[model samples]
Target: MKVLLGISSSIAVFKSIDILRGLLKEGVEVQCVMTKNSAHLISPLTLEIISGKRVIIDLFEKRERSDILHIEITKDADLLLVAPATANIIAKFANGIADDALSTIFLASRSPVLIAPAMHTQMYLHPVTQKNIEKLKSIGVEFIGPYEGELASGERGIGRMAEPEEIVEKAVRMIMKKTLKGKKFLVTAGPTYERIDPVRIITNPSSGKMGYALAEEILRRGGDVILISGPTHLQPPIGADIIMVESTEEMKNEVIKNLEKVDAVIMASAPADFKPKISLSQKAKKESIQYLELERTPDILEEIKERKGKKLVVGFSAETSDVVENAKKKMISKGMDVVVANDVSKKGIGFGSDLNEVIIIDREERILSTGIKRKKEIAKIILDFIEKKLSN
Candidate 1:
């Protein structure tokens, strides 16, 4: 992947260095373009060293190999990203004013564009800037955040630049072709907690990473996503509609409530299979504690399948034994279109880990094994399968 990264004059421009590094880590060839004013805040040589490409600063700067630098930089580029996009740059792009290297590239590029706006709270909220933003949006230009947080001015409002990681994710998504547009999806993630007492609970080691990755991939594909998740410390993907649930019952309720609105459902949450027959009202006293009776929690996937009417259902089975066989049986029994099975017992993968290896089996006996890989990569593979299923 090749990205044309543009930087403008915002104090937040410093964050673009991280953005450049992140793109490089993703194996993207990055060419950086900086407005003249941005050089005053951060040296262009700094970005040049990080990107390993000459940072374009002047529209007519002498180039040993090229004359039209603005036009040349965007050739074969997959995406054009403006990080720490200041009000000046946004206005210039909106009004078709190409006075500098960055704005000139904006006018000349054919690639999809993403802008991460950063400015004073008042400047961002000003009617003029808002109009410019709307105009840009109308023309197919996408934007991420000027998220709320502490600013250089020591005043907190909604104009701080989004984190570099987020910017890079958005940039990657922007460069991809949307396959799930007009489709709505529901994803259940994390480990549901079943309270055993006032303070104690039963849960699994699910980190919610797989499910959240699914949501992010869905959003990247331009799908509408509802993420119903159990308690986890991870930040919810920005474009997803999040529903937080604590127990299996709550998760089931939310899923059942919104099931009809979505075209497909990805059930990645690990709901407790059993719970204490009777939850203690108060903390269990050491002397009073004895054998606790257990009862099976309601099977959410089974229930959804029972009531399913044309909607595609995708399930996950994290098993220590019978991996593929059990997953196939579950897929058949539960009427799932596909079941992703993983061995949670494996070292370095599954459970609370960042990586997973799974076999995807459908009722048709079609199976595909994705060897151990990062959850994010696994998500794209899953989506690729789901997209084919939905298309048919």
Candidate 2:
């Protein structure tokens, strides 16, 4: 396969050489491009020597002998890859701001695009960075990993780009899953809080990992995603449009705002059971330990069902016990076309973990369960179900 690699400014960029080595070993042709900032960390000539292709460092470098312009030439490759994708570079791609050579190649590419994000853990975890990733996923881009490991700053956390071989494996898997190209999805995930005071709130442990994984899986299948998520510590997939919210009410508002023009809505966020009867204007001090009045919050999924009209609605039910039975009931009660049920009581299978085991029940009562697996693998299973149902 003909591959085009885009390197951005990140300390982890030296890893790209290993990726180039791996790709060449597999007999794939490699072309390299580097942003001006990335060149400071890794030499352009080094890339050219390793890949046997002259590196393209500028958008208007005189085009050498190609009749086509730089952008046009870069567009002809099978895939465009960005290793060690910095937050700044991601923001550019997310906002359609092509100020640099690598950004131009990304925007110019017609082929499939893959990104491997790397940065400071705190920066990667910031909401804005997560939103940029979400927006890119919503546009049909793919990503490998910003796995958890020690960063150059001597702090250990997420934001390490996946190992070069693992990146190629993901790319190969992506190339294999061209089944749902150009499809669009509306996905929701995480726990919605209900605030009683500026600082006090009620929420579940729903981590939104499954939902984010599903979004990535959808992108890998060459699909667009609109991911609406509630309060969670997790980052949205690197190429989705993320709508963030704190309370179920806010989540409902955002969902209603974006509900149109979507193929399906996956109601995965576990909205609050009840809200304060009187929400305080300021943070309530618990030093006094006073009794608090409470009122039920609006059922987001049910409201969604009432207003859905025609969009497919899927719900998630995390039960401490009696998973299937409760999920079946929730399917009927929430007016969901499909209900994804998981047993949270099981060790390592729920909330905050990288793996999940789930049973999907449709309105027709067809139950499909997957064994324990990585969140991404489980997402693919869910997408397969979604694709099959959509086709029918």
Candidates' lDDT values, in order? 0.91, 0.82
lDDT of 2 by residue, 279-381 (tens): 8888766885478788887777877887888677888888888899999998888888888999988998778888889999998878899999888778878
lDDT, model 1: 0.91
User: How well does candidate 2 match the true structure in TM-score terms?
Assistant: 0.62
State, as a TM-score between 0 and 1, how close model 1 is to the true structure.
0.90
Error of 2 at 140 (Å): 17
Model 1, residue 60: distance off in Å is 2.8
Q: List clash counts for every candidate, in order.
A: 0, 9
Per-residue C-alpha lDDT of model 1 across residues 148-235, encoded as one tens digit per residue: 9998899999999999999998887777678899999999999999888889999888899999999999998899999999999899
| Candidate 2 weakest lDDT stretch, 10 residues | 168-177
Best by TM-score: 1
By lDDT, the best candidate is: 1
Q: Candidate 2, overall lDDT?
A: 0.82
